[model samples]
Target: MRGPWSSIQSKLVFLIAGISMVTVLVGFSLVTERFAQSLRDSLENDSLSLAQRLVVDSAAYLSLGMAGQARDNLLDKVVLNSPHSLALFDEQGGLFAEIERGGGQIVVDDYRPESAVIWESDWLHIYQPVEDSLDQRIGTLYLKISLSQLSHRMRAFVGVLLVLLLVMLALAYFLARLMQRYISGPILTLADISRQVRDHQNYSLRAPVKSSDEIGVLSQTFNDMLETIEQQQAFRDKVEQSLRIKEERLERAVAELQYMANYDSLTGLPNRALCMDRIELAIRHASRTRTYAGIIYLDLDHFKDVNDSLGHAVGDELLKATAERLSDVLREEDTLARIGGDEFVIITTDFSSSDQIIPLVSKVVERFEQNFTVGRYSVQSTVSLGVCVYPDDGDSVDALMKAADAAMYKAKDVGRNTYAFFEAEMNRMAVWRQQLGSELQHAIDRDELYLVFQPKVALESGQISGAEVLLRWEHPEFGSVSPADFIPVAEHTGLIYRIGLWVLEQACEAVSRWRDVGLEGVTVAVNLSAAQFRQADLVEHIAAILARHNVPPQTLELEITESMLVRDVDQAIRMLKRIKLLGLRVAIDDFGTGFSSLSYLRKFPLDALKIDRSFIMDLGKNRDDTAIALAIISMASSLRLKVVAEGVETPAQWSFLAGHLCDEVQGFLISPGLRESEFISFYKSFSLDEVIASRNV
Candidate 1:
C-alpha cells in the first residue's frame, strides 16, 4: 500500500490528492466549459425563438394560403414542445413544410438567408424567414435541435462536475489524513529511526524529538549522525583493511599492465594487437553462431631461413618453440597469435564443418614438421598454412586477416609444406580485388576510367598505323568491368600507379589528336604496370606526358610486359635507355608470353614485338601457331625489331600476317577498340582508304 510516491504517508496522500484533483479538475473544467457555453447560448436562443415563432405562426398560414394547413398544426407542436426537428421552406426552395422528426434530412436548401443558428454533428440548425404583412419574404423556418436535449444538459452538467470532482478528492483525502500528523508523522519517525539504524548496524538508535519542527531539526541531525557513527567505528575497520589491500594491489597492477600490453614478449603469443583483438572476437563469434571462423595464417616456413641461419638467440628460441608448438594444437577456444616476425595468427571458433578446416590445418602443418630444440639449436621448420573461413573467407577483422594473408600467399604458391583454403575462388578475387581497388581508387576521379583505341594495322602498309591504349571499366554497379577484369585489379592495388598515370595523360591526348587530325604517323600504345614500371616517376611521367600532349616522341608508344622486362634486367636496361632517350617507342607487350631471354632480349633498348594473342589465336589452324607467328616475324626482322601481331582475327589472319613481314597488327583484325571519337573517325577517312581497299580485294 505504500506507493503514491511510497510513503511519507503516501506522500501526504498524493500531495492532497494532487491538489484536490487539480483544484477539482480545474474548477470543474472552467465551470463545465462555461456551463457548456451557456447551454449552447440558451439552446441557440431557444431554437432561435422557436424559429421566430414558427415564422410568425406561419404568417397566418402564409396569408391564408393554408401553408399545408399550418404544417399539420405545427407538426404535433414540434414533436410535443420543441425538442426540435421543425421545417417549412417555400420561396422556391421547395419542402414547403415538414416535421416528421426522425432527424437529419432537413434540406430546403438547408435554410440560410442570414442563418440565425446552425451547429451540425447531431443537429442544431434554426433559421426563420416567413414575413408578409409588409415585409414580403414568403416562407422558410427550420429548427433541427436534437443535440439530444443539449446532450442531456451536458450530461447532467458532467454529473455535477463528476460529483464535485469526487467531493474535492474526498475532501483532499481527509485533509491529507489531517496533514499527516504534521507532515507524515515526523517523517515517518525519522523513517523508522533510519530503518532501525539501517537494519541494525544500530548506531545506538534515536530519532524521537517530537516538535521543534523541521522534524525537530531532522531529529537533531539524525542524533548527531548516530554520535558520529558510533565514534568512527574502529577507525572505519582499520581503513577498510587498508582499502582491501590497496584494491588487491591495484588489481595486480592492472593485470600486469594488461599482460604487458597484449602479450608476445618474444612469442608468449597474442600480439598483433592482440591478434587483432582476437580476430575481432572471432568475427563476432562467427556472426552469432551460424558458426565457422577459422584464420590460421602461420607463415614460419623458412622462418627467414631460421632468422638468417640461427643467431638472435636462436631466433628467439625459434619464436618461443613456435609458440609452444602452436599452443599445443589449439582449441581451448583457440587464439594463438604471435603476429610479429615469423607471423602466427590462429584464431578459430565453433567450427563443426568447412571440412573442419582441413583437419585443423593438418594439425598445424603437422606441428611444423617436427624438429625444435632451440637453446642448443636443432631447427628444421615448415609452416605456410593460411586458411581464412568465417562467412566464406572474410567478414572482416581486416578482411579475415587479408583473407589469411592471401591464403598465405596461396600457401607459398602451392609448394611449402602447405594448407590453403581461402578459395571461394580466392574469396571472390579477394573481394573483387578489394572492390576493384576501391573502385579503381576513384577511377580517374570518377570518370570510371575510359580510353579505347585498338588499331595498330600496318600489315606491310595496309595502313592505320598505331592504336592500343585500352583500359576500359564503366562499372556503375559492375557493368563493363574488364581490362581483363580491372587490370589485375589495378596491378594488385597499387592502382597501377594511378592507372598508369591516367593512361599516360590519356595516351598523350590521343597522340595530339592524331596530329590535329592529319592522322600523320599515329602510334598510340600505353600499357605499363610492373607497378607502372617501377615508377621513379616513370621517366619523368613519360617525358611529361609527351610534353603535355604536344605529342612528338614519335607519337608515344610505351607498352611493357615481358613480365615487366624481367623484373630488373638492370632496371630494365635503365628504363629502356630512358625510354629510348625519349624519342619514345618501346613495345614488348605480351610477346611470346614472358620469360624473355635473347640474353635480356638483346640487351633491352630495341623496340617492337607484340605477337601474343596466344599466338594470334590459332593462326590458320595452328602449325604451332604458324611456327610462333613465323618466329615472331623472323625475330623482328633480325632484332632491328618491329613485329606487332596480337589477335589479328581473320583474312587468313591478315593474310598470314602480311605474308610474314608483319610490321604491325592489333586485335579484331584492325578496329575493335575505338572510342576517341571512334578512333578519330577510323583514322580519318578509313585508315589509308580501308587498308588500300582491303588490299585491292
Candidate 2:
C-alpha cells in the first residue's frame, strides 16, 4: 500500500528530481524532433538540386548520340565523392539509363517516378525530370542519401539522458537517508529516557540535549520535572519515617500506662480493681451456667509476726515469692489475685463438689508452709483460707464475699493455718455473732453467760486438787450451746472480754458456793485466749474478776498458750508479772507443741506445762512420744511446775503417764466431760485408796 514517495524525505526528493527530469525530457524531445524535420527537408532540397544537375549533364550526352557512355560518365561524376545513389529514366517511363553510384547500390526502381523522393529506413530518395537542349521530357533522375549517421546521433542523445537520470536518483537516496537520521534520532533518545523513568523509577534521569531545536528544549523541560519529582519523593519518605516513630512511641507509652493500671508493680499480679472485676465476672458466669464456682479468700496467719520480727523489705520479698508459687500451682482457668497486703482471692469455676477443691486448698497451704529464704533469713508462714461456693453459700457478689470472709475468721477461730468451707449454719452463726457482738457492748449490765467447774483429780491418789472453769453459753432459743462452739465465736467477735469477765465473776461465785458446801481448797483454772491476753487492761480485769467473786487470787489459775507467750514475748512477760502480782497462777497451755525458745521459757512466771493430746495419744505406741513426755516432765519438774498429760484414752496411756509421775491426767477414759451434778458424784466415788492400791502394782 505504499507509494514510491511514502517516506517524507523520499517524497520530497522524488518530487524535485521528477520535475527536473520531466523538463529535461520534454526539451530534448522537442529539439530532437525539430532537428530531424530540418535534416529531412535539407536532404530533400539537396536531392532535387542534384537531380537538376544530373539532368543538365545528361542532356549533353544524349545530344552527342552517345547516351549510354555519356549517362554512365555523368552518373559516375554525380555519384563520386557524394553519399547518394542516382538513377536515369526515359520520359516514356521506361528504363533508359540507370547509374548506381557510391558503391554501385541502387535504392529504388527506375521505372517508378513517384519513388524518386522517398525517405525510408534513414535514407532519402529523390525523383526529378532531366531535359536536353530542346527541353523535352527526356529522362527522370532519382537520388538516395543514407541517414544512418543522424539516427546514430539521436541514440547517443538518449544514452546521455539515461546517464543523467541515474546520477539524480543516487543523489536523492543519499539525501533522504541523511534527513531520516537527522529527524528521528533525538525523538528516539527522548523515548528511551521516558521508558527508563517509567520502568526503573529513576527520576534523576533526563533526556540528552544535543541541539538548540524544539526537541532539545523539550528534553531540558523534562529534566527539570524529574528533579522536582525526586525532591518531593525524598520529602515524603522523611515524613513517613517520622510519623512511624511517633506512633511507636505513643503505643509504648499507652502500654506502660495499661500495665500500671491493672497490675501490681512489684508482684506483677492483678490488683484490687482487677480482682474485683474477675470475681464479678465469675459470679455472673456461675449464675448463667448454673455451675458451682468457688472463691478462696486467704490471709497469711503469722504475717504480722514476720513483719515485726524481720524488716519490711524481707516481708515484701516473701510476698513476691509467694505470688509466684501460687501462680505455678493454680490452673490456667482459675484466677489468683492479690487484693491487698497479705490477702489474696482465688476464683475457681466448674467445680462439681467440695472434694474436688480440697486438694487445691491443701497444696496452697503446704506450699506456703514451706520455709522462705528471704535475704539470708529463713521464715515460715502459713495461710488461713475460707472458701465459699456459688449458689450454695450466696447468690450475690457482696454476700459471697461476706460469707467467705466470715468463714476465714472461723478458720482463725479454730486455729491458724487451716481451710474452711462456708456452711449454711456458719452463715446463721455469723449473723448471730454479729448480733451478739453488738449486744456484748452491754453484757456487763446484762448477765448472759456463766461458768461451771469440773474437778481434775490426781491419777495416783484420785484426790480432787483442782477444777477447770469452763464458760457456758445460755442462748434463749438454743437453750444451751456448748462452750466449744460459742466460746470461739465470742473470742473472734471480741465479745470474749465481756464473756471472760462474766466467767471470772461466776467462778468466784462458785468458789463461794463450794466453800459453803465444804469444798473450799480446790483451785479454779480458767483458759485465756491471745486476744484477751493482749488487752491493755488485762491485769486489772483479772484483779477485778477475782475481787468481785470473793475468791482469793491464789485460788484462780489463768492458763495461757505458748503462742501467746512467744508472740510479743516482752509484752507477754510484763503482763505475766502483773498477773502474778495479783496472786494468780499462770500455766502454759499446750506447752510442747509450739515454737518457743527454751531459754525464754523459765524466765516467765509459769505454774504448769500441759502436754498436748497428740503426744499423749502416741505415748503407748511411739517411743519418741514417750521420750518427749519424759523430757517435758523432767523439765517441768526441774522448773518446779506441774506436768499434766491430756487425752489419756487407754489404760496403757494412763499407766504410762502414772509411771512417769505425771501430776494430773484428764481424758475420756477417766470420764467424759461431766455435768456439774455428774462430776460431783464421780468425784465422791473416786477414792484415793483404790488408785494407790492400783498404783502399788
Candidate 3:
C-alpha cells in the first residue's frame, strides 16, 4: 500500500532536504547582499578620491584666469582614467568640458555640492566641492561612475552560493537516509510481521528486539501478547478436556452392565456389555478368517460445552443423531457400539490393511461435519477418531482398544475433527498412559511394587560381585507393565523422587537380608534417577538408610548415568566425594552414552565405570562397537577403576571380554533378574570354571 513518497524513509529524506534548501537560500541571500554593499562602497571611495584630485588642479588653473587650462586639466585626468562619463562644471553650474567612455551619452542627475555618493539603479554618483590652497571654494567637482563591475561581482557571488546550496541539500538528504534506517528498520519489520500474523494466524512469529529503546519495548510487548494468547488457548483446551475427563470418569464408574439386554437403552445400539464380547469375537474371527481386524475408537469433540450450553436433553439428542450418522456411514459388517457418554467404538469388517478402514472413518468424520438438528435446537459437533488394525496394532482386544483409544485422543490433541492411526511409540499411547499413570499413583499405597536383581559376575572367578536392583510392577488389570513405559511418565510427573526413595529403601532392606544370610560381600547397585542424584540430602539419606539397615557401606552401590553429572560436574564431584566419605561405592552407569568429558571423569571421586550395553550387544561383530568397548575397558583400567560390560550374552562376546581382562559383566547370559530366593541359590551354585570352559568350546 505504499506509494513513491509514502514510505517513512522517503518522507524523512525529503523533509530534511527541504529544510536544508530553505536555510541555505536565506543565509546565501543575506551574505550576497552584504558583499554587494561592500563592493558599492569601495567603488564610491575610489571615484571620490579621483574627482577631488581633478578638481584641485582645475581650481589652480581657474585662479590664474586661464579657463582653457582648467578645461585641459579635466580632459587630461578625468577622461583618460574613468570608464564612466565625466563632466566639469563652473561655479555657475555650466558645463565647461565633457568626457564620455564607451562612446555612450552621459546623463547626470542633480549632484550635491557637499561630498556625497549615490546609486541610481546600476550607476554610482559622487559629488565633492573643490577648494583652493587658501581654503576658498573655487569650483565643485561632480563625478559619475557606472556600477557594472559591482553588479558583476554580486552575480558571481550568488552563483557560488547556489552551488553550495545544492551540495548542502544533497549531504543533508544522504545523512537523513543513513540515520533513518535505525528508526524505520524495526518499525517496518514490525509492520511486515503484523501483516503476516493477521493473514496467517500464526502467533509463533516474533519481532526481534535489538535495543532497550521504545521500538524494542513495542516488540517485547507484541511478543508477550502472543505468548499470552497461546497460553490462554492451551489452558482453555486443557480445562475443557479435564472437565470432560472428570465427567466421563464419574459417569462410567457409576454405570453398570445390563446383562439381560445387549443394546444401549438410549440409542438401541450395542452397549458396553455387547461391545466387549463383539470386539473379542471380531479379533477371533479375523484371526480364523485370515484378514486384519480394524477397530475405530471415536468420541465427540468438546461435547461438554454443548451439554453445558444447552440442556442435557439436547446433548442426548445430539449424541443419538451422531450414532445414527455413524451407523449409516459404516458398512453392514462393521459393529457399532455406544461405549460410554459421547463415546462410540466400531469393530470393522475384515480388511487386508489399514487402508480399507480409512474410507469408513473418513465417511464418519465427514458426516459429523454437518450440523445435527435436535427437536428445538440445532447443535454443531465434530468427532475425533483413532483407527487400529488387528495383529498390527495389537492381537488382543484390550491392546487394540487401547491403541485406538490412544490414537483418538491424539486426534483430539492435534485440534480434533480428524482421524489418526495407532503409532508404535510409548509416548503415543495416550489413553493407556493415562490409566497407567493413574494406576501407578496408587501402585505404592496398594503394595503392588516388587524388586528384581540382575547379577554382575567377576570374569576371572565367576563370583557374583554385585547385582543391579531394578523395580517392577504388576497392575491387577494391565498385567506386567514394563519399566520403560512408566519411568518417563513418573519422571515427568515428579513421581520419580518418591519412587526412587522407595526403591532405595527396598534395595537396602534386600541388602540387609543378604548380609544376615552371610552374603555380606555381594554389593547391590541401585540406579539413581537424576532427581535422586540431585537431592541435597542424598548423602545423608544414604547414611541413614545404611545405619538403620545395619548393612556395610560398600555392600550398596549407587549407579549414576553420565547425564546426571554433566550439568554440574563440580557439584557432582562434591556429592560423590561425600558419598565416598561415607564408604559407599559410586559407579558411572552407561559410561559412554552421554556428554561426560575425559577431563571431567578424571576429576570425579572414583569408583567404577559400567560400559553401556549397546557396545556389549555387538562387541565382537561390530568393529566400531568393539573398538569403543575396548577403549572404554582400557581407559577404565588405566584409571584403575572396575570396568563392567553389560548385556554380554554370547560366547564370542564373553571370550573377547575375558581375553581383554574385563573386571565384571552382567547380562541375560548370566541370568535374568531373579527373586531373592532364586538369586541366593544362583549365587551359591555359580561355577566360574564351567562358564570359562563353555566359552572355550
Candidate 4:
C-alpha cells in the first residue's frame, strides 16, 4: 500500500477515499440507531393502547351487570382481531380466562408477573388493570404481542441501510479518484518540470496546463517565467561574446601602443627614451653588484655623404643594416639603441674594467669599416665611438652621456674611424669646464668680462686696417683665465649667448671709443663661437646692440670658424645672410682647419678670411703648414675676401705670411693683448711706419 501510494495521484486518491468511507460509516450508523429507537417506541405504544381498551370495556360490562356476556364478547373480539395472545384473571389472583388462536397460545396462572416483556421468543407481553366506575381495581388483563413479524421488518430495513451505505462508499471512492486526477495531476507535472529545469537547465520546457483553475493559472505563469529566462540567457550570451571581442581588441591596441612607445618605428630598435631607461636600470644594478658598465656613443663618420648621394630610402636601409650588425655583435645582456638619425648607443652591462670594453668597441669599428650593400648601393662607413664607463667617467646618465659625447668629439679631433675612452683628464676638464661656465655666467652678470683690441696690421704697409676684439675674463678668484680654456666651456654650457652679447656690446663700445679718439675707418672683428652662431636671435641681438651703441655696422665684424659653417651649412648660410642684411661684416675665422670646400667658401658672405693659428704656429717648421697657409691666402684673394693670418709669435712667421700676400696679421708678434688704457697709450706712441721698418730689418 505504501509503495503504491508513493505516487502523488495514488496518495491523494487514498487520502480522499479513506475520509469519505469514514463519513459514510458514521452517517449510516447514526441513522440506523435512530430508526430502531422509533420502531420500538411505536410498537410499545400500540400494544399498551390495545390492552387498556380491552380492560376498560370489560370493566364497563361488569358494572352494568352483564359481566359474563360482556366479558365473553370482549374476549372474543380482542382474541379474533388482535395480533397478540390474550389472558384474563379474577380478583382472587387465580386463573380465570385465556385465549389462544391462529397458532398462538395464551395461559393464565395463579401468579402475577413481576416485569413486562415487550419482545420474547414466543410473545411480547402487555399488561393492564381492570377498574370500576369508582376507580377500584377489579381484575387484571394481559396481552402478549407476537414480535416475529416486526423482527423481520427491522431486519429488512437494516439490510436496506447497509446496502445503501455500501453504494455511497463506492460512489465516494469514484469521486475521490476523479478529484485527485483533476487537482494533483497538473501539480505533479509542474513539480517534475521544475526539477528538470533545475537539473538540466532546460528553460525551454513548460508545465502542462489541465483546466481553468488556480493550478492551471500557476502553470501558465510558470511557462511565462521559462520564456523570460530563455530570453535573458540568450541576451547574456550575446553580451558576453561582445565583451570578449572588445577585450581582445583592447588588449591588442595596448600591445601596439606599448611597442610604439618604446621602439624606433623605422629601425625597430630601442629609441632614446628606452635607452635612457635601460641606462638608469643598469646603473642601479652595477652599483649593487660593485661592477662597472660601459656606454658607446657612435656617430657614423660619413653618413651625410650617403644621405646626400643616395636617397633617404637607401639611408634608412643602411641604418637598419647597421643596427642589425651591431645587435649581432653585442651580447644578449647588452642593449643597443638608435638615438638620432646617424647616432646609435650600445650599452655593455656587467663589465669588469675598461679593458673589457676595448674588444667590443674594436669589433664594432671593424664591422662598420667593411662595405654594406643596401639595395644595389654598396657603401663603406666608419663610426667614431666614445666610451664612458661607470664610476670612472660618470655616475649619472646625463653625466655619462655628456662625457661620452665629449670623448666622441675628441676622437674626431684625432681623425675619424677610431674610438676613445673617457680619460681622467677629460673628467677633470669637465669639472673645470663646469666651473668656468659658472664663472662666465657670473662674469656676464657682474660686468667683469671686457674686450681688448688686438690691432690687425696690413702686410704691405704695416698699417692698422682693423682690430680683432678678443674676449678676456678677469675672474675675481682665478684672476685671469685664457680664452683657450674657458671659451669652449662657455660654448658647451650655452653661456656663449650671454657672453657673445657682452662681446658685441664691448666691441661696439670700443669702436665708439676709437672714433672719440679720432681713429677712423678701423674695423673691429669679434669672434663668435658655434653655439653663438646657432642662436635664433643672434642677428637680432647684434643689430640691437649695434644700433644702441651708435656704431656703424660695417665697423663691427662678426667672426666665425669654418667648423661652424661646415656643421649645418644651410642654417649657417641663412644666418650669415641675415647678419649681412643688418649691414654687419661676416668673416670666417680660423679657416683651412675644417672641411670647408671652395664652393662653400665662394657661397658664404664674408669680408675677410683669417688663417687658423695652428698653421701660423708651424709656418716655418712644417712645409705642409707653409703650403696650407699659402693656399689659404691665394684662395681668399681669389674669392675677393681679405686674408688675415693670426697667431704670429715670431717675426719670421709674420714675414712669411706678409710675403704670401696676406692682407692683415694679428698675434703676439705685434703686441700682447692689452687693457683699454694701455692699448690707447701704446697706439699713441707707436707708428705704422716704425713697425714696418722694424719688420723689414
Order by TM-score, highest first: 4, 2, 3, 1
- Candidate 3, 263-348: lDDT as tens digits: 88778899877888898999889889989888889989757546644557788888888888888877788899998788899898
TM-score of each: 0.25, 0.47, 0.41, 0.54
| Per-residue C-alpha lDDT of model 4 across residues 151-234, encoded as one tens digit per residue | 777789889988998898889889998998788888888889999999999888988877778999999999999999989988
List all candidate RMSDs to the true structure. 37.3, 21.2, 28.8, 9.2
* Predicted candidate 1 versus true structure: per-residue lDDT over 126-195, tens digit per residue: 7778889889887777777677777787998899789878887998888888987787787787888788
Collision count of model 2: 2
Question: Pick by TM-score: which candidate is best?
Answer: 4
Highest lDDT scorer: 3
Score candidate 3 by lDDT: 0.81
* TM-score of model 1 vs. true structure: 0.25
| Model 1 global lDDT (CA atoms, 0 to 1) | 0.77
The better candidate by TM-score, 2 or 3, is 2
RMSD of 4: 9.2
Per-model C-alpha lDDT, please?
0.77, 0.74, 0.81, 0.80
Pairs of residues at least 3 apart in sequence or in different chains that clash in candidate 3: none
Number of clashing residue pairs, candidate 4:
0
